[model samples]
Target: MSSVRRLRPVWADATPDPAGRPVQLSLDELGTPLAEVTFVVVDLETTGGTPAECAITEIGAVKVRGGEVLGEFQTLVDPGGPVPAFIQVLTGITTTMLIGAPPIEEVLPSFLEFSRGTVLVAHNAPFDVGFLKAAAARTGHAWPGNKVVDTVRLARRVVTRDEAPNHKLSTLANLFHATVTPNHRALSDARATVDVLHALLSRLAPLGITHLEDLATATDPVPEDVRRKRTLADGLPDGPGVYLFRGPGDEVLYVGTSTTSLRQRVRSYFTSAEKRGRMIEMVRVAQRVDPIPCATPLEARVRELRLIAAHSPRYNRRSRFPERMPWVRLTSEPYPRLSVVREVKAGDGATYIGPFSSAATAQLAVEALHETFPIRQCTRKLPLVAAPGASACVLVEMGKCGAPCTGHQGPGAYAEVVDRVRHAMVADAAPVVEAHADRIAWLVAQERFEEAATVRDRLGGFLRGASRAQRFAPLATCAELVAARRSDDGGWELVLVRFGRLAGTARVDRRTDPRPAIATLQSTGEQVEPGVAPATAAHPEETDLILAWLGKPGVRLVAVDVPWACPVRSAEGLGDPATAVAALVRPRLAPDDGAPVVRLPGAGTERELDIAEARPVTLELDDARVIPFSIRPPRTA
Candidate 1:
């Protein structure tokens, strides 16, 4: 659509307004009062649909502040080409009538001057802005990064589709009773857009969106109840902290933490942009927000974890199932075995390995331990006396087990192996590493290269599991530990930890002496017994949380009441387990010497086979025991 009736006489000379003022509001000033914002509603009548092929026929703009027009600018430009007959008929801008109009080079600079220092507005803004930006680029003028607002988006949020059949400029102008009708003219459309912007702003006022950022993001589909409940965030603290949304009955509807202001983060939920239906429902029932001020972001994170654990808030999905976290435990019996348990029971004498995120990981750790040592795998309680005439299990016949249940291995000897398992769990893993190396070497010597690689990977997995266990072991055994990090505001954020649990946290003001605050925190922090079972521990989840926090950069160890060290020969000395495992498993060729190592039908006896190239072999022993094997070639120099 176009206008063909533009016939205004051209001015003699271009008189550009004084250069546009720079936008006063910094990007961070998103919360700036809307009433004081300068908005420039702009419209362009173009020769065609896209900027690449189109030239501006006319430019029109109205600058307003506080709903009052401050100025108006309008000008027609020469396209330097013939206006199509259809476009001339549609817009009333005849080619003959535009004979001496000023070109875009003159019209663009004045328009830019008029729009300076204002947030640009238009119905479906990109079309108008795109043309202006293109013109500025072609004219060797810098395209100022002006903040833009699209009335179409604003209308979508304010006026429902039911209120207006569509968001077209004419439809919205008619619905809002705009002062100037949109009749395919640049000036008239720009004026209509100005009115629509005001109408949308009025709708936003009741929704508590008085800030520029709020209006920009207001098109998000927010529920009516959520919009009304925005008052809950009005008085919230603007600082790093944990916030809880509580229902009328005071039950926590949701819990979260923010490194920035709690008020800003909580207020974000009230806007139409919050699309999570669950969050919207929570906000509807949320009657108040409770902010727990934290001195540091880390402290807020810790508190959020603990609160979510304690309250099991319906909206909080993570850390709520602390009880479901798996722990790798050594059974408390004459023959100890690694097992995954959900609860860490007191007085069980079982060494607990973790509150692993999942049972699969805990099982992996257990499997690693079994691969590294001859720990008992049986669940049955054994007597000092062996049952007479009992048949041995397959593991016993295959030499995988010493058969402690049948007294093939003495209790004293088995206890020594159990002691090594315990040592590997917390201190030294040298015995497991040495044993794995020896086994890998033996397999390689026997021409079982694939089995050797498998052994190496198993050992790597065990070492990694052991390394992680050792890292947490010291913290779990400590009576108390204090750690600190520099806060964003140049203050110290201190945390008091006991038995691997976050006992208390405090943020010291930059101007205040930290010693007093530290002392107060130390006195008030919960005391926990070192090595207590998780069921009886102050906070089982805190150990993992603290471990993760310590892993982050810039955290400093402030103080410790107990010995804080790991064994010098611990598994952590093992390099990246995955890299090590991959190196060991990589396929390599072995020298061939013709020999019948293992018989396979349809394959010649002269075919030399490396262990990696061997097929699976199952042997049925005389005692009815099955042993699986990978057929290997004879070793050759």
Candidate 2:
């Protein structure tokens, strides 16, 4: 592509590019002076503070520009209901006073028109604006998306406790010596608030806040030294990407991603829109920003996770230590037992199940498996055949384990039990679901609803973990998978995913052919070898992110080497155990090209499945000398 057609970041300034495209600049790039800005001080009286539950009874506003009052708008509204006694006493506006007033439907149009294209000002902005917004919604009127400022917030920043005891409109009115005294009526309070706004602006004037943008952030708790760091936001790409905030000596202080303009999002940290104390502190020590531009928002988010994990910046709390996420591993030893581990080795030869949400949830899933199949509860490394003098544990007495240590079960017999769990981890969870179904239904029939619900949750966790593992395994070993999605800008966002990792990405302009872009992507994309199954070459969380992107609406699969297939019958959606058992054994639709076959344990039938779509797959569990550990089915129907 020529330079004129090359993709440019959205935040590039309006200076015409080689293509002569006329680009418009964002507000922060070209600021408006406060003297030229219109501010409307508004106040409202309502039945209550809850906007959703309350009704607006009155509205008052004064429009000013350059400290000169241009106009005043006032209206009394019939709220369509009686005013509460407490509210009537508080504002001195009764139901009788509102009887002949125009309804909010009549008043909203005039008020919206009067406040159009101006910065809204109020005592407590959310309280006043919230009422108007709620009224607009209730009356089906379009509310203007205007800038808002609260005089109370402004006073807190500009006026100290030495100037006033509290930052209230009434208290500030007394301090500022307003021309009009606030008597709790709408117009009177609005006029007083206008005076307070002017007084606060006068105090800020000495600090050189003469622009609307400066006024917008003047009330933020950010210190002046930190505010001076706003220049760090300049020169970042104007499109979706990850941004790193660097402290002195170039240590990364924070990692963030923006699907919108990187400059715009980075600039927000220096303004009032960013209110987190930790972030404000991060911005304080930050000296510069580094941009990592991406072709798609999904790639940006995935890279954000990877960077957070790689850097483990002190400021980023989550995704900093994904390695700490626990996984339930069915150990590969002779007497295999399920174990919760924080790490996975590629050649361990052990079957793995999850990087579960939490260690607790992973343990619950293990217990669910143990409850259904007597895999083993012992952590001891038992020999293939038990020694003559080896002893068994209490669980063996409880029939929860086939004690391989004492030769009660041989490796062949033990493997049968372990195989059932292995199946649940990677293939089919039908056995686990079927195992829990009868006990759960029996408990429900016995009026033990809580017990049944516990089993249900445990079963759900195991199913989710297993299904997640199954879903991630296919893409893990796939050498390459190229896909594309439509971008919001009428362009195409192309991605090169390798072993579940984002190897390369490109965003094409809508007017350009995406074929050349895709060709460039596949040739220049990072080269990655397939990693172990389940996790593949990328982190499970990262794979989850990629899968999410692939699964989004309008994602087109350009090419792939691996056949994407999962079990058509998942471990969910059955009303009862019998139904689940029946659902598990039913023959699934199979691809004509010879997919894998699953032999249902005890069902005495083999079923083939279609792997074209990679749905959920299941397996049957076989336990020798099975003793009922579950609540035995009740005698009742």
Q: Give a tens-digit lDDT track for model 2, residues 322-367.
A: 6777778888898888888886678889887777888888888888
What TM-score does each of the candidates earn? 0.70, 0.65
Which parts of model 2 are misplaced by more than 4 Å? 1-141, 150-217, 220-237, 267-277, 332-335, 357-360, 381-386, 389-391, 410-412, 437-461, 571-637
The model with the greatest lDDT is 2
> How far is 511's C-alpha from truth in model 1 (Å)?
6.2
Model 2 clashing-pair count: 12
Q: Model 1, 416-464: lDDT tens per residue? A: 8788788887677665655554455346446565665565556655665
Please report, in order, the local distance difference test score of every candidate based on alpha carbons. Answer: 0.70, 0.74
Could you tell me the C-alpha RMSD of candidate 1 in Å?
10.5
